[model samples]
Structures are given as C-alpha cells and as structure tokens.
Target: MNTQQRTSTLQHSGVNEAEVSKLFRNTYSLLAMTLTFSALVAFGSMTFNLPHPGIIIMLVGFYGLLFLTTKLRNSPWGLVSTFAFTGFLGYTLGPILNMYLSLPNGGSLVTMALGMTALVFFSLSAYAILTRKDFSFLSGFIMAGFVVLLCAVVASFFIEISGLQMAISAGFVLFSSAVILYQTSSIIHGGEDNYIMATITLFVSIYNLFLSLLHLLGIFGGDD
Candidate 1:
C-alpha cells in the first residue's frame, strides 16, 4: 500500500497508519512463523540423523528454492516456496549440528550461540524501528562484503589458511547483523512490501548468524 492508502485507511477505519503498519505487522507475523517452521525442520533433521548435503548441493538447493520463491512471490505458492526453501536449509544444518553436538560443550555452545543471535537481532531491529534510522546507504557495502565473503569461502576449498574459517565466521556475524538492520530498515521505509521475501531475508540472516556464532564459540570456548 502507498502513503495515500495508509492515510485513507487510518482516517476511515481508525487503524493507525494502516498500510505501513499492516505491512510491518504482516511481515513480522510471517517471519515468526517461518522461523518456527525452520527450527522444527532443523530439529527433525537432527533427530533423524539426516545427512548434510554438503556445501555444493546445499548452495544449489538454497539458490534454486530461493529463485522459486521469488518467482512465486505474489501467490500462495510463494508461501509454500518460502517454507520449502527454509526447511531445506534447515535440513542441511543437521550434520553440522551433529558435529557440534559431539563436542564436550556442544549443547552449551549451541545454546549460547542461539542466545547471542536472538540478542543481536532483537537489538538491531528494535533500534532501527524505534529510531527510524535510514540504513539504505549500507546496501552497496553489504553486497560488496557479501561477495568478498563468498569468495573467501570458495577460496577456502583450495587454500587452507590457518585462521580462514574463523575469519569467515567472524565476517558472517557482522554481515548477518547488517542484513538484519538493512532489511528492517527497508520494511520501515516501505521499500519492501512483500513479507515472503522479507521473511526469507531475515531468516537467512539469523540462520547464518547462529552458525557463525556457533563456529566462533567452538573455536574459542569449546572442547579442546
């Protein structure tokens, strides 16, 4: 909905800033549901001891489903595609989680990472919405950082640096947090109207953030 529509709805229906407000409300609602669904799928994957698809296949599945969701964004199929994409990604985490779970402090590490992710996301998002800061300027920088990180990851396959993995994980923590802020800002400013896409963006950010934190914790504080 546009600004005029929001004003009209507010005046007519007594709903405060209906268009933007409704958009924010819907986006968050869908994000919450999708995150829950992703969590359940991840848990199921771990419970069943599902094998990880590895990085190559994992990327293919994620990008492919992501494409599908983008194409189907205007229909009910979009929601289906969103869940499929998230669930697939969640399933891929099973093996990684399993590896961590085998560590002496695995459970605590996972819990700590999760707690940190939650804290960071909520803090950043609330800051954006409450302060109404425009983070749109970070768009180019975030994209560039993402490309650099992706290249670093791909390069890791052939070049084994002593601290490369840790560095990548560290980069991701900041990258994902920036994404959360950027996406939230987009929603607040009405640059994004589609909740499905918004949900995916934030979900991916949180997912990566958790994994990065887990990796960092494992390296620094986990079992020797």
Candidate 2:
C-alpha cells in the first residue's frame, strides 16, 4: 500500500481500538456503580425491616429491568437498564442479608459471598487471558441448562422438596460457573464487540454462582 493509504489504514485501526477500549471501560464502570447501588438498597431494606411486599417489588422490578436491559443491549437504553437491574438485584439481596444477619454466623455468609465473587472473577480473568480457546460452543448448552433450572425453580414453589432444591442448586452453580468461563473467553477472544453485554453476562454468572455457593454452604455448614 502507498504511504497515504497506510496512514489511513492506521488511523482507522486506531479508531477501532479506541472505541473498543471505551466500550470496555464504560461497561465495567457501570457494572461497579450498579453493584454499589444495589448493595446500598439491600442494606437499607434490611435496616428498615422492609415488608415482604417491598422485597417482592424489588425482585419483580429488578427482573423487569433485566428484561429491558436484554432488549436494549445494543442501545443507550441498555446501559440504563443495567443500572436499574443492578439496583434491583441489590435490593432483592436485602432479604437474604437480613436472614443471614439474624444468624449467629451471619458474617460467614458475607465472607462466602466475597470469596465466591473473588474466585469467579479471578478464575474467569485468568482463563480469558491465558487461553485461546473459544467458549461460544457452550452457548447452547448453557441456555438449555438455564431453562431447565428455571423450570425447577418454578416447580419448587409448588412442591416442597429438599433433595430437588439441592440438586437444582448444585446444577445451577456448575452451569453458572461454566457461563463465567464462557463469558470471559468471549470478551477476550470471541470478539463480542460489545462490552455492555459482556459485563452483563459476566455479572449474572458471578451472581448466580455466588448464590449457589451460599446455598451449598448453608446446606453443609449451617450455624457451625
């Protein structure tokens, strides 16, 4: 290529890189903000002894926001949706916090949450950086697993069963952990091209994993 053509090509590539960096930065920054806001809401809810109705509202509202976020993943609205969803998640977490706080070993729950979060992030980050393998292949399996898990969750409401709950929780934890690996791989090499979606996926995976781990811990280490 001629000198001028080379210069033009370089400029275009530079622009692309800059845009990618901006997208990545914006996604993570927003993710952090959302997490913080949600934590605040959860703490507030627990502090005030919020009613079950309010907690339910937070749950429904958060999921509604999640639906919006998914639908608007490619638009500016997606960002707003993410913010709302995270805040809702934080609020929904209040009840769990309240329950755990009431326990003598409540601090263990918080510690478990922090530990799980750290493990997920560190493992996924490592996988993303060290491996060249594409995890998109797991997409279909993850979806199917999620659907099954959702069905089980819904079914649990109608049927009281400990074994089933344990089974489902175990399955969900494994599935979400896989999702973390997949999402990380996608961000690193799958060429997702959209950091907002990436962060959302990663956040969801981590959240679910944490919940699952907590469930397992409660099952095995209750008040001990």
Best by TM-score: 1
For each candidate, give its TM-score against the true structure: 0.91, 0.82
RMSD to truth, every model: 3.7, 3.3
lDDT per residue as tens, model 1, 1-224: 69999888768655434766887888889888888888888899999998998778988999999999999999999999998998898888878898899888899999999899999999999999999899999899899989999999999999989999999999999999999999999987878888888889999999999999999999998453
Runs in model 1 with CA error above 4 Å?
Answer: 1-16, 222-224
lDDT accuracy of residue 40 in candidate 2: 86
lDDT of 2 by residue, 74-176 (tens): 8988888887777666666777767767777777876886797777777776776577578889889899998999899888979988588788879988798
Give each model's whole-structure lDDT: 0.89, 0.75
TM-score of 1: 0.91
Worst 10 residues of 2 by lDDT: 50-59
Kindly report which residue stretches of model 2 are placed more than 4 angstroms away from their true locations once superposed: 1-20, 53-59
